[model samples]
Target: MTESGTLYVVATPIGNLGDITQRAISTLQLVDAIAAEDTRHTVGLLRHLGISKPLLAVHEHNEQQSAQGLIKRLQAGESIALVTDAGTPAVSDPGALVVQGVRQAGLAVVPIPGVSAVITALSAAGIVQPGFYFEGFLPASGSQRRKRLEILKTLPTTLVFYEAPHRIVECVTDLAAVLGGHRQLTLARELTKTFETIHTCGLAEAVAWLQADPNQQRGEFVLLVHADVQEKAEGLDDETLRILQRLLQELPLKQAVALATDITGQKKNELYEAALAFKAANTHE
Candidate 1:
């Protein structure tokens, strides 16, 4: 019986061809064939590297079906390299199903990691928060996106999101509305490309900044929302605290805070802080 071949999950440059890693190039050259998110896009990268291999179209539309075929190839002792149009595969991108399927079949799946848009943006963001929540792309629906943001609003860690150029203006508007205009936001646009721009400002100012220059709204964006630090809850009276805690038991933290604000006429930020404290106290017990 022939030994099963390895499946390499390689990360390519997000932009700037020079960013491609030596190991990634070597793996691509060595693989029997490559499974690409977009064959037309991957062909350019492969051509640039002077590597030739059979290209298979394994995209979101046919990932599950493609996975089975890939497994059969690996079983036939044909090594394969999986790559997305840019950055790593299976991360806010296709190839996840293929990787999962290959693994379940007991085939070896190796990672040749390199450039990632998320890590690249966060590296230069200058955010002091110790950790981050990578929310990736939010729902395209405005109402659904806002609902998700509401739940994430009070998080004490940095929030990382990916946004498309066309929806950037509207996305920023919703962000300011739900996450608060006062919070700091870092916009990393067209990363690693010729027109790359990284700017930081308050959420309220993000929309204006993007609109003032049309070019600014023309590329992929990585938005970094600064962490929310809970303020002192000393101003809350016993009645308000009681009300907030009671609401917390039956509602999400953001909802609890909002209802408490209406009931006690306390500031929303203050009520949010109190709600976090109450939840933390309960968690430790």
Candidate 2:
């Protein structure tokens, strides 16, 4: 910081208190003042850690006003820390304005990073990572939320979204219809909590399981939707199976298998069976 005041961005736990990092603890202990998205929630966290500091609420409604006060605190050489109720601050969370405004005032913004639910969920998902789209919380409204899902339908990459516990079942149903039932999907719930559950299934089954358990309707959620079976492989028939094996003679096995199965809804096993039979027939001739 130009004048010796600095703002630290602290990450709190999503559910379990033990997830907080030692560096975050030290930073919070060191800061002169703290800005929180919710004072009551932050108070509980501080109480858990036995920390007492001046806290100012800096939520979405009054970010502009809060920015001015936090800047003043920094100007007066009071070190400040920003935190959200859960996860790292400013990632679809509060602390954006505080972090941004402090940097504009020529103050240093230090990030005290810890467990993030998004990253936490992704790590457990078995999908191979190339690039993923993080769609943090869908629009709460029906039409708008489905529309948002619709827009993401064409994206050919692993997709992630944050969901409220109550609306997740409905969201999955919509996802099943729009994204199709066959897509591989993963759902994570109440992460790091005692009843933490992660399940990978076809989209339709995930909806059914959520419906069966009344308790599943509670807690934080993260969902991963794998890309749909791809446009080139959209529809195929059994008649094309033989031609596919012939084409595979000069092509790599994986690409040939993808195209062959894409053109014929035949099980990969059945296609491979036909391929073996074709090879034997050609060898015998």
Please give the lDDT score for candidate 2: 0.77
lDDT of 1 at 152: 94
- Model 1: ten consecutive residues of lowest lDDT: 276-285
lDDT of each: 0.85, 0.77
lDDT by residue for model 1 (113-229), tens: 999999999888776557889999999999999999999997877899999998999999999899876456889999999999998766777899999999999989999987743
TM-score of each: 0.81, 0.81
RMSD of each: 9.2, 8.0
Ten-residue stretch with the least lDDT total in model 2: 276-285
Clashes of 1: 0
lDDT score for residue 68 of model 1: 98
TM-score of 1: 0.81
Model 1 residue 137 lDDT score:
95
